[model samples]
Target: MKSFIFRQFEIRQSAEVFRVGTDGVLLGALADIRNARKVLEVGTGTGVISLMLAQRNPNAAFLGLEINQEAVQLTRLNFVNSPFHSRLKNIHQDFKSFSTQEKFDAIVTNPPYFEVSGSGKDKIARQTIELNFRELISKSSEFISEQGVFSVIIPAEAGNEFIKTAEEYHLFLIRKINIKGIENSKVKRLVLEFSLTGKALDESEFIIEKSPRQYSDQYLELTKAFHVFKG
Candidate 1:
């Protein structure tokens, strides 16, 4: 089976869709959604983040949106097979045009950050060609409740620009996690959380590895309930 077995659930994979990666795992394990009732996941490649968040926040209901048809189908399959299926729903829709009367308490995404350049099956899922940062920020600001958060994981180099764009939409940064591949290495990714109302920013660094090929204790602890790591 082309699947990743987790402690609580399993994710079926496909070559046509974006596969599971550290970015999604970090966002899933780190995104703040404890008090949220309604959560929205943008670009749910395999519904992994939503499943993880569902496991974390048992009371939250998730709506996952995917632009790619194949990925949307894949996400639906994954969502339905999970233990949290009762709380999850997946739809094939472009986020830019998605409208909802309901406000989401937590809007999360591991968005496409790369510029339009590559020609591949997962191009739309990896590049900003379909959904740019500005559009994402604007829509998230509109859909988020007053106390709600918009969380995302993106390239470290794009953090400053992404923050600036979010500010223009009246979304203030509330929390930040700088992700390093290994101890003493340069930060490679950022898990940022923004909200409609500003507050004292909480910032922290997350090291994924304590040494080469060894998962950091912090990473292991954070995902202990989800990742089924061999002893």
Candidate 2:
């Protein structure tokens, strides 16, 4: 079975779509769930981030929106079998056309960022073929509540540009975590938080590994609650 068992939940992976990995886990674990009563996760490949956040924030209800049918089916099954089934819902829809009367207190996504040169399934997974960063910012600005927070994890190369675009919509950065694979490695991923208040940014670094096979203390500490191996 292509299933991964976590301390409080399990994810069944589908070969035809994007699968869970360290990036999603890190984003879910590190995002601020404070004051969040309703959450929305965009591009929820298998709903892993939503699951993690739901587990961490027991009072929050979650809605996961995915563009792929395969992923929607898989996420639905995973949510159904998890303890937070009553608090989670999965929908198959493109974010660009997604309409809802509800406003979310927390919004998170691990969006596609690479600039690729093809029109294949892999391109959909790696590149922004359907939804771009600018559109994400604009739509998020419209739907996020006054005190809500928006969070996302993306490649370092595109992250700065994303921050700039978000500023265009008056969504200011509140917190940022630079992610490096190791101590001396160049920054590769950025986990960022934005809000309407335009508060001063709280910045930090997170190294994923101490060496080739061992996880760093920061990574282990951040993910210990969900990762069985961390215990």
Candidate 3:
């Protein structure tokens, strides 16, 4: 399970504490990366979203920040072997203590879900990149350029809480896509975009699987370019 393959890129894990998952895929697909010039990703586990962003926007250069040493090594490797490898630059640092004299046109992230308790695998590794809701929003707001978008994938129950938190920073809500495990399943995650502007915009939901062993066409389309399992 340490090595995972996507249609566009192959990920090296094991040294990777967090392997690629549905949340990262949903954020990569649902993000609006069309006109982005610069982008940033916090807690960039395996650099999955960074790789996805690079695939989506070949012209956009990305800065992916991660704190895990093993993930840092693997993300760097992933970027090296990826299609848009040159488009990315990764840093081994924490989002809180790390700052720049630069601003990004777009930002995307998949933070840790606090819905479950930790197993104490790597104390510093887990807590730092745990993807806390508040820190992510506040930091993105500080780094994003005006009219730019901030995108993230998070647990559905915790997603709304992020909106409320961002409102405090004047980072308005833009669009959202909710992710479900299956057609009739409960909402599992939210893929959202935020900006300095807010308008009543279109939002939708996606069901990943039509059946246990069968992934839906829509899901395949969104992730087809990324998953090798899909032909």
lDDT against the true structure, per candidate, is 0.94, 0.90, 0.80
Tens-digit lDDT track of model 3 for 1-231: 557777788888764377777788778877898989998888787888888778878899998898887788889999999878878888888887878888888988777665445576544434534446787788888988888998877778877778899999989888888788988989988888889888786698888999997998889878777777724
Q: Candidate 3, 43: how far from true, in Å?
A: 0.9
- Each model's RMSD to truth, in Å? 1.0, 1.4, 2.1
TM-score of each model, paired residue for residue = 0.98, 0.96, 0.91
| The best candidate in terms of lDDT | 1
lDDT value, candidate 1, whole model: 0.94
Candidate 2 vs candidate 3: which has greater TM-score?
2
For candidate 2, write residues 1-231 as lDDT tens digits: 478889999999977777888899999899998789999999888889999999999999998988888888989999999999999999988999999989999999998886676556656667888888998889999889889999999988887789999999989999999999998999989999999888888999999999997999998888888888933
Model 2 is weakest, by summed lDDT over 10 consecutive residues, at 117-126
Candidate order by decreasing TM-score? 1, 2, 3
Model 1 agreement with the true structure over 1-231: per-residue lDDT tens digits:
379989889999999889999999989999999899999999999889999999999999999999889889988888889889999999989999999899999999999998966577688988999999999999999899999999999999999999999999999999999999999999999999999999999999999999999999999999899898899
Pairs that collide, model 3: 6-226, 6-228, 7-226, 7-227, 112-130, 112-131
* Residue 28 error, candidate 2, Å: 0.9
- Please list the residue runs of candidate 3 whose C-alpha ends up more than 4 Å from where it truly belongs after superposition: 115-118, 122-131
